[model samples]
Target: MDVREIPHTEATEATEATEATEATQATGAAHAAAADATAAALARVRGAARAGHPRALAWRTERLTALRALLTERQDDLAAALHSDLRKPRSEVDNAEVGFTLREIDHALRHLPGWLAPEPVAAAALGRLPPGAAATTRYEPLGTVLVIGPWNFPVQLLLVPVVGALAAGNTVVVKPSELAPATSALFASLLPAYLGADTVAVVEGGPEETAALLAERFDHVFYTGNGTVGRAVMRAAAAHLTPVTLELGGKCPVFVDRDVDLAAVAARLARAKFANAGQTCVAPDHVLTDPGTGRRLTAELARAVEERFGPDPAASEHYGRIVNEHHFDRLVALLDSGRVVLGGRHDRADRYLAPTVLANVAPDAPAMREEVFGPILPVVHVAGVDEAIALVNGGDRPLALYAFTGDEAARRRLADETRSGAVNFGLPFAHLGVPELPFGGVGESGFGAYHGHHSFAAFSHRRARLDVPIGAA
Candidate 1:
């Protein structure tokens, strides 16, 4: 039929109906394809697990060694992939992504034997057992597990957990974030070569593919991203009674006391907050301080930003662009929430946002309404430490709480009073580097924790074993 010859409304309706039908068909096909891919990946990993391929300490060590090789041998390839996806500088690629994962692997390799060892329970602790009886707790793998990565810090966050899963003697299905396409592709292409295609598989796609993957049962599902999607993953996991470890983000707060080195504080805060163009999950979301300290610190922060990025941050090689336009626009809108004391410039085509600082931001300001996962830093004036603590206590618990104060009393107060995943005194985000410390959030941020020994524990089932002499008792 010639649509031009037909009535305008009728022609338009007919075209719309046809377009809608085609769209529905395309969506269905995509889902079907995703299901097929997921099924194949799961089957491979499950087969490996069932065959007890991953149960051997030697097998686990070999896989870990291969992962280390991937990081070390392909350092340039990984750096280039990360730069393509995030515009991440080579130094950051080394320090945060490649080197970070390498360190995690090294730690796991060094400690895997001890982590897997069974612990004997004393007879007295067991309340007196029969002669020749023994009791112990053994760490066992949870079989095939799924790891879902976030776009930010794609390499480290995704592989670090996988290191733990493998160290604990389990096969893994890795889902690298589709947002970081280059890195994702790199993982899909390289992981098979290094870790083998059967046990550790990389599945790449957006939410649809993820949903398809979640439909199948897994021993464990570890997701790192926002809370909204974390809830959805939990719901899907519930279908099969599958366990999940959600590493989510929230508005991490920074509290500045009246007495302290404001310049030093500003310098540290600027480094921590503006790194990765402030897309960090543990970045300071807002600054809470007295009006006097807020004024002085704001000025110091301006100086720090200038010193770090020079006159124009957009031209600085070390400075990063927003991950995408959506985040850039969201960060741009936040500039209006308060007076822009520093760095309000942006270029949409380049996806560049200067390290922005907003002063006199009210409690109800738009920027304070949610997790500002960008280069925008908001300074909220408060009466004092007490008021700041009250304000923080009143809201949903943050992932991290930072206080730069020499006053031991104030520091203790913040540490004792605040309900957060972690408390940092004098600096922010440093705890993440310490592998001994458990990294995860409470309340809205996240539930499960993982890092170092904690990672091995997260993917392991600690079973209690008891052997008694039936005749001896």
Candidate 2:
């Protein structure tokens, strides 16, 4: 049975227009509903904060325990989600993402009691209060905090900040990146069950949803992503006069010394550079060394990639795939920027790119100019340590600086001269694992540090108080 369509008339056209308007109205209403839902959730968390539930040590500990359980009990689920979202290897997922966050939680739990105590401070001599005056500072929670996680390291970046915000006795609203949908959905589903709806809530969506969440006032806003989005977060936060911690990424540099073990250095560089397909914030963005060392290091790097990921890294179980096709294409275009030393293979369909090393790369090349957040390492030739220092100082300070040297003078010079978030002697990206050390960046790379006590301090406001004997004066 075939039926022919009626000829176009004013009445029929008007009916079609009315239907389109209704559909548009329905979409707007749905969006309004979603925004209202987010607003309502945020209001609940804010109410919880005002009630002082999170201020109790017992309450903080209970939440931390639940977070540990979530990681330990449902790790397989998280790993699978990460694999689906970013093609992250199971082993890498366990160590880099899950284990790293667990360590942070453990550290926070152990030190939270001491961290919560009020700290004594010496009274200022210039502005004397009285004859017998005592002063101290108390760490108070900054109400509800908004934690916006990046697509790279979705779980760790999102949850780690929550650990700090919670430990500091603040409720948190987590917005997981929509790019990693599987992980984001996993978090949105699992977090409420573990942390409770009132303490920690997960909101999932893209830029529009993020903008909606940002519209509301928060005590603090912690964002982990590229500088562009970091700036946007800062701009939004400014509307509320809210404090923010921008954990951003840039072209982190590595300086290779001629005296160091080339083989071991190459192996370590490969491990750090290619881990999670080089989507790490502190991954060695480029290598700086003398021409002679560069030649030897280049060959050793080629051997290291083959040894670790095997000749055909695409087939290797240890190697990870790029996050998405857009990133894969961006990485493919970078190969043309410099002479490929070892790896130049890429499969956009599989989102697989080999651990590539480019040598004799110009300083102004695209890979060098931008943060090459992929498994691509570019080696730039420098005259000596002085030249390397000059080059590093020329750009915006990076999140981390890696200098491989046994020389005391060189180490001291590099330590005193350069500006970066953290400095590692031989290894790169190792500073993040240590709970004692603060992880963050300087200048354009980012601002504010957080890990153990730093995390506690970052989320808490230190309010000063003074008590004086009025009768004495």
For each candidate, give its TM-score against the true structure: 0.94, 0.95
- Window of ten residues with lowest summed lDDT in model 2: 1-10
lDDT of 1 by residue, 277-315 (tens): 898899999999988998899889989988988888888
lDDT of 2 by residue, 87-145 (tens): 88998889989998999999999898899888877546516666678878889899999
Give candidates' CA RMSD values in order.
Answer: 2.9, 2.6
Give Cα-based local distance difference scores for all models.
0.90, 0.90
- Strongest candidate by TM-score: 2
- Candidate 2: the clashing residue pairs are none
